[model samples]
Target: MPKEREWLTFYDWARTYGNYFYLSILGQPILVLNTHDVVSDLLEKRSGIYSSRPRLVMAGDLVGFDQAIALMPYSERFRQLRRLIQRELNAKALEKYWPLHEQESRELAKNLISHPTEMQSYIRHYAGSVILKVTYGYQTQPKDDPFLLLAEKVMQAFSMASQPGAWLVDLVPWLRYLPSWSPGAGFQSTAKKWSDLHMQVINGPYDWAMRNQGLPALAKPNFVSTVINQTDADLTEEEQSLLLWSSASLFGGGADTTVAALSSFFLAMALYPGVQQRGYTEIQKVVGKDRLPSVSDRKHLPYVECIMYEVLRWNPVTPLGVPHMLVEADVYEGYHIPAKTIIMPNIWAMLHEPSIFPEPHSFLPERFVGNEAAVKEVSVAFGFGRRACPGVAFAESSMFVAIATALSTVIIANARDMQGKDITREVPYKTGTISHPPAFTCSLTPRDGAELLSIRT
Candidate 1:
């Protein structure tokens, strides 16, 4: 297995080993599923045994991520966390957040058009603002929000800590028991610092929400508020802990995913102007220039929606979905899968499968148009089975509005050189757990008929 950008290597290996292949490292068996059918067969058809998560000693147990929903093992606590989140984030419950999503996404378009050079920073701010508001009723500062910075720090640490083979403790669990001063024990000190930050992120926002819950001017009906209000006024230690960790899970999972998807969308538009033009045309036809495009206009804007799907397919946010551990030994298609085998679903490979999506690497939204199979299959990009991200509805809503709003407001085109020639596509993507389009300059010229008043929040 490669040290970094494992997804690319996994895709290459899939060509030789076919859909499903296995490897054992230091007696630890790993199963890499490279196609949708295989992932669905095991992760969905046999979800009972495929939903458990692998224990990452360095990232999970050491850095204090084990309590977060994404890395928590399959157990009662995990179920409780899922239930707490699903109650507020489900499609029906998410109706309350539409206004919040639209408000922030509109602000995003306004900020991007005003400060076109800081596209990536504005995108981060937009995502951080949305998730922070949804998870806790706290509003972000216009610039350099402390909560946003803390979340960024936590996510950066997680990306490095959770990466496969990045930390030896994950492979050799015994190393975690070593003292910080011992030789080869430097990770202990790092984990200690990250663990402190993790606690703050998990506790800081939730505490503020609680303290302000009773203040009329400060209180807003949000996930933390709603969860707290529904429960007993004086909660048990377990219940409060559950609420804190679960609510924190929302920001941890939702923010980065939103940033990655929107980043990829901008990159795609820069690379493929024709598709971007088509999307802009669809937006103008469906939603007149009198106002910005809202998430509600999604159905009317089919081409725009296709562009969103294609962006996801072209460069998935989580290229390799979080590893799931087999619950017990089982047989599948004449293969004996031992218990505890780490299941890595190569989502990038599935999205790029030639048979499922022809010209898989090409940026083509038309593939999803009038094609139910292709559309349904792409759902794997979110994840699969019991472990699939519960924020699907929320994710899609935020992404669609952001994409639609941007299309209505600006034209995303490549930057020009000193001689005025279009700078050709060179940088592709940054590889990690969540893949983002490498930084590239894009001109965000305001679209004709789109006025400053239309994007005002």
Candidate 2:
């Protein structure tokens, strides 16, 4: 009830009143689940009645994202689109994309060697390029690209719309019908402008590929052409429109979250030089510098895997797992849960459990090694139930390839000051539905004999 950061608020609430609590905000009943067991029981076990999303009038309907599967309500359409995405991004399917992952991530490492200060941009390019290539078969030159700029635009709208009580129209549905100039009804203009931007962001790459008409010669079959140009494709106009939205959602889901996770990875590397050194030693043992780290090496390199898990647990991008709406009334632990009640998982608190992670706030990949029960789970970072992130396999593989390749090639240390002393700044991260580190500086010197993974590899 007090005015504190959401993480602090959720953590405090969980610690004081146990892992579950109920409250009313803006006349809406809300349930927050913080522990792993309760979340597993309700969101995962009773998924049949907990898969729908609460109404997001401002962020989804007004900002024109309702059609995106990530925001779409649970329905036949969402199920179909999710199946399509899973087909292309599931664990087995993601193997085909490994070459692209390897290429882009190595490119990021090379770019960092020359421009260490621009590490953040390089991470964005790697993620955006991979998703765009897979979803639309479009290659992004990236510099001054309007589409890249749109990713920033998406984040701005996303951050604003996700903030509770930020827009009055969300609370009062009738305000949506108010004229653009009406008093106490400015959300109309905001929605209209964002709607146009959202459309362009989703459709731009597909439009470019269509107009180019040389899509057939591209390196691979992208989601856009593969679906719209199918011999069996006889879609109604509405079906086709939804298909377009679904294709874009692939990039929407992967790009920002990947950026956040990767940025956090860098911050982790910077703050813990000893950890980086230890990880580098493991990399050399498993993956020789003759070639970059590949997915094939994941099994042999347990420390690398531990680092990946630790990064996700240490600072998950989605602190409060995406809100879900109850489809029917249910009872849990003797408490009544009414239909339509909003459910949110306090992912931050669960991931930060002091019992599991001894020094919950500390960065220690070793906590995940040799002990499953002693360590907090990392899969929850992807969410839970039928509405869980469909891009989990694809996203995990993307971050893995990127972090593994980058770590193998670079010495990521805290940047040095003009006087030649090590400079350490307090790590600061932005809080929202999507979390990310603010701009921070780091040093990336090439490792011994660490040439770029040969282009021909």
Candidate 3:
């Protein structure tokens, strides 16, 4: 458990210690599973006893996020709550929401063409608007949306609180229960500030839906409204509260992670021109210039699909999954394991394993395209077993359509400086549980006469 931003240093330790290792941090035991096979065997095969989450005192309870589906303790109620999210986000259900995705994705291409310099803002807006509309039926403002800012602020606080040893109170559970005035409890103040904003995200949309329930013609159907309409009499207060939190996790889980990966997609396009050109050619031949790409085009454009996989493989957003807590003790390879130990999957190490992926360091989609059989496994980056992200189908659809449309309509190039030389320097990604490509100058130009339609459409 490193306190500093050098958490990836554990990757070096993985090289020396082999895939699996156990250690004790401040008297708390931790099991680090690094290889894909071991993670599948332990976390996937033995999910019954490994699906619980380690109690995050500061980030969860104190910040009013304990109710969040991702942070909730392993319980039947939480499982049911997550199932609700899965029902709405599964591939079949997501098709009904394609109008939302198609409209925003088209806006994404137009936004890139209109504001080439602010790729970060438009990328975030594209992802956020999709989730915002689907989950809350709320339309997003073009820039400086209040809801987007609050969500980012709340999400930022959670990210800060999740560092290995940033908050001592999280390590010492008793410290979290102390009064607000207690010394060394500044985290409580910080948590309150974020939770206040969190309340708006949690209740604002739900309450709006409740007030507009009867007027079907005036109402904009969304996830919150759908859940409310189907279960008003059957749902207990606790169940309703669970639904609210699970739905709000869309912004935290869906928007941030999706936006981060899409940003990496842009970086990859800039760095690997040949791969980008091939992907562009594939999109051109399949979809042509009459219209922008759509979700239906994904199956025909396998190379573009490979680019999405390679982007995720190259830079996983959550390298170390939300830690899993053990519910029972078991021995693996004759080693003694104890119950209640925290299980941490080193996803970065597994995805970068050279034996599984030749030239793993390179950004090559051909590795996945050439051998489809080897890649036929569940995604570990989103998570594994029962605790896997419920939004995988929805997320992949969002990335696929956006990438396809962008490739068909734009050319991602290196920015040029005053001397006419490309400013091709790259910055290191910020260190965190959720990582993103650092801000860099990149030139985005429309492709041919077809892009003129993109601008007007």
Candidate 4:
């Protein structure tokens, strides 16, 4: 299958092949876990053996070896990095940063009201700024700052490197031994460029903050500062690099994924105005126009909550999800999974399963609002087991505040062409590791004049 249609193509195959299916990509076993039960069995129940990441030959050899938390084996270094992430991005830590999230989300709403033409860019900036501010104690003011630009370049390179046929080195490990002047040398050189760019982005702000301790008090303490202040005497340079890599991982993972989900949310709103209206009504009833919806008001906004859940389920950011690897040889239902076999929990298949989600193709937030069981089960969008997104709390809170505030304040209308018909319906996604709606126009008029004036200030 072509990369663009990989998810839908795999879904079709999974329907025909049952839950357990395997395909060889360049002589490497690629196991797809199609059902919730199977994914849970391996990723959640047997996490100790299933959480290791499959080695990307090009990435591992060219990039810093064993210096990437996401790609590292399940060793002590991995454990330490994971522990730091869990502490920094956990529920309590997310709550601690709620004020900053709220402030940035409000700024996002104001930006939309002022420059609706830059809606997509603002979304990217908002997500990136929030993560950067929280993770590095630095806020990205100019959207095209050098650090942000380098981050984008790194993402583009990473995406290219991640493509199925991007590098033959992945398939033929022996080719990695070729000299720098070889055809595959570009991949290594690009990887080095990415590493250098990322190191500068990660360490520059940190070094500055270390020199001027307690100088500027932002809304909250950033993750980098917190990590630096933490007492980890045994942290090696390799471990520190891995920690920095994990922070970069958050920007890479959290920024694009959240923006994609929110973009999907807007698309859903345009397609189903009633769902959007219902969410608005619920929020209005609970928290009147006197104040915007805050984290404290989330529980009272069930309809909005359901909408958020549906957005994730409708089109997950990582449709294939981060592939999990087997640490030790294992067998499931009489099928032997060799050690180091690449395991992928096909979240696309699980979320779109007919038995689990009725009319899975449709945009129906009510399924979650009507059925409690579905909400509990739909958590697979984040992934399963130990390797699940550590920033779930932070991501969820950011999305909620952004979505609820946007719904409550703006009148998100579909853009019409010269013929006066919706143009967004005709837009399609450009292919990548993450799916994003192709750029389409939208109007963000404030619901009322007062709301508009408030945003102006």
Best by lDDT: 1
Clashing pairs for predicted structure model 3, backbone only = none
For candidate 3, write residues 1-457 as lDDT tens digits.
6754343666787778878888887777888888888888888899888898887777777776767777777898778888888878878888888666777888888888888887888998898888877887777888998777777776667667665456777678898778889888778888888778878877776665556666652225578777877774867878677777778776578877888899888888988889999998897788776777778778888899989988888778887777888988998889888997888888777777787777876788888876764365327778988889889988989999888878877899884443555544343566666777666657898887445444544
TM agreement with the true structure for every prediction: 0.95, 0.93, 0.92, 0.90
Pick the TM-score winner. Answer: 1
Q: Tens digits of per-residue lDDT for model 1 on 1-457?
A: 6876788898998889888899988888999999888888999999999999888998888898878888999899999999999988888888788888888888888788889888888999999999888888889988899889898888878877777657888889999988788999999999999999988888888888888887863436688888877876777899888988888889899888888899888877887899999988887788876877777888899889898898788888888988899989999989999999999999989899888899987899999999999888889888999999999999999999899888888888875443556655543566677777666557898888657435468
RMSD to the hidden true structure, all candidates: 2.1, 2.7, 2.8, 3.0
Give the lDDT of residue 177 in candidate 2. 84
Q: Candidate 1 has what TM-score? A: 0.95
By TM-score, the better pick of 3 and 4 is: 3
lDDT scores for all predictions?
A: 0.85, 0.78, 0.78, 0.74
Inter-residue clash pairs, candidate 2: none
Please, what are the lDDT tens digits per residue for candidate 4 over residues 1-457? Answer: 3567467777778778988798887678778888899998889999989998777775556654335565567788777777878788878767878888788888888888888888877887888788778877776765576566666666555555554434677778787677878765666677778667656765665554445556664424877677766756855777567667667666666667888888888777877788888998998899887788887688889889889998888877777776788888998889888887888777777888888789997888888877877887778988778888777888899999888888888878785443556854434555665667666667777875326436433
Candidate 3 positional error at 346, Å: 1.0
- Candidate 2 or 4, higher lDDT? 2
Pairs of residues clashing in candidate 1: none
